[model samples]
Target: MRDFLTKKITDIQPSGIRKFFDIVSEQPDAISLGVGEPDFDTPSHMTQEGVRSIQEGRTFYTANAGLIELREKISDYLLFRNKVNYDPKTEIVVTVGGSEAIDIALRTFVDPGDEVIIPQPSFVCYEPITQIVGGTPVTIDLKAENQFMLTPEELEGVLTEKSKILILSYPNNPTGGTMDREALIKIADVVKKHDLLVITDEIYAELVYDEPFTSIAELPGMRERTIVINGFSKGFAMTGWRLGFMAGPEMFMEQLLKLHQYTIMAAPTASQYAALAGLKNNWQETVEPMRLSYEERRNYLHHALEKMGLTCYKAKGAFYLFPQISQFGLSSEEFALRLLDEEKLAVVPGSAFGKSGEGFIRLSYAYSIYELKEAIQRLERFVTRLK
Candidate 1:
């Protein structure tokens, strides 16, 4: 018998985050801050709308591009929030999730040997996806001195004739760093100079703290070249709904929709209706309140970590805190495992994000304030023991 498998798929490393999560799950006494998922339930209105859609027999497949009304709502939401206009009919394709939008975007643009410049420590998906698509993932190490935000110098340093796409994930996962408008303006200038296409993942946009979120797409001359990926998962707490969308120039979207049509056909119809309710009605009531709670938790955890003598960068968006853990003289994975064993508290090793994250550990603030306090106490005890 001959074994049959694509070497590309087999050669890729499994997700480091999930491996730790699996270990923590078997410990019944453990409290996990490992996953990046929002702890809140999907808001009631959105769930009710999903129920209504099912009751009304909306379980059938929508158009390959998704429900027109939902796409229109997404367009309006982006225009009002990000100040970028995309035609619902031609410029947007509803995806299974922002994850799928990412997959399709890479597939639509990257060819074998094309270089996709990815900044790290950031999300884990970009590199593997680029590899699967036969694209070389060129990683730029994001420094803590810069708050993990990608700099123009870093971008320029990684640029080569083969460089085709620059992947920007801000309100970034793992680090929780965000790029302000001025920072984006500098980045946009570099991107424009190099004529590089960009895939900006703004899934965490609504959860930003301290400052208003700005989309790179909103920068002048950027709307036509950037693909903005956003969804109901992070902001609306609808992760289980598995719905997201990509907005960009029609030239790209036209090709993207073809891949979506053949590969996925359409996003789930009921989920589309649920997302519509979220965009249209739940933004003010449900989304804002959840954001406020996350902000409060972020504040509490930041102060707590600092008091424990860890060097923590203040995160302006997303629900994570990446605290430098090198002072303990243990690798991130070793520290996390020991803490879990001694304290029954779980956190993701920062190295899961990238090699540059080796000296850090990412703690999510998506849990309740009470849970956060307990976790912090355990963390302090763990650090004291090391001291």
Candidate 2:
């Protein structure tokens, strides 16, 4: 059995976030701030639409690219909101989630031994997926001083003749760092100079707090070279629906669609229609309110963490706060385990994200204000004891 397994699959470590989550599940009184999932239920209108689709017997598989109407809605949404235009007909492929879109994008462009530049303390999937595809994962450690935003110098520092793709996860997971238009433009110039393509994960785009979200694809010369991955999970609280899409130039999308056609066939049909309803009707009524709630929660958690003497970069998007825990003289894993043991509070160790995250921990604020407040109280007590 050991001989039969591919080293590539076997060598990859299991998700560190899930390992802690499973442990927390067994402790009945534990409060978990580890998982990055939205606490809100999928909007009522979207769920109702899914139920109606089934009630009306619309359960058959959609076309390989997905339901044309859904893609068209996605196209319209991107154009109207992000100012980037992608043709629904040829440039978009619906996926099993933004995760699948990421895998496919790497497969589409990267050849064996090609280099994929990944910034650290990002969502955990990118590096392992790059390895499974036989692409070398070149990690850049984003600094706390830079607010964890990847600078143009950082991008240029890792470029090589073998570099094929750069994975950009802004409104970043764990850190919640976002790049403004000017920052993106500078990075775009570097990408163009190096002739490298980009896979920009914008799953958290709609949740931005300080400023409007800007896509790299919206930057000059970027639309043709960047693949945008977004989905219903983060923005619409539809994680269980497992629905997302990737949009890019037709040339790359054609290859991506081929892989998706063979591997995925199409995204779930009911989910597609439900997502259409979300895009078409729920943005103002459902999505906006949820975003506002997250914003409020973020403010509370940021202030609370700072008051407790945890130095955290103020996150601009996403629901996470990555705070430096080095001053306590404990590894992130040690601090996290002790926090869980002493306070029955759970958070992800920063090292779980990457080496760059070693001195920190990621706390999610996607829970209710009541839960966050209670967690903060526990954390305060825990920190005082350590001091």
Best by lDDT: 1
C-alpha displacement of 241 in model 1, angstroms? Answer: 0.6
Error of 1 at 372 (Å): 0.7
Per-residue lDDT of candidate 2, residues 227-327 (tens digit): 99999999899999999999999999999999999998999999998999998854657788999999999999999999889999999999999999999
For residues 256-359, what per-residue lDDT tens digits would candidate 1 score against the true structure?
99999999999999899988988885466778999999999999999999988999999999999999999889999999999999999999999999999899
Which ten residues in a row are the worst by lDDT in model 2? 279-288
Tell me how many clashing residue pairs each candidate has. Answer: 0, 0
RMSD, candidate 2, Å: 0.9
Compared to the true structure, candidate 1 yields what TM-score? Answer: 0.98
lDDT score at residue 127, model 2, on the 0-100 scale: 94
lDDT per prediction? 0.93, 0.92
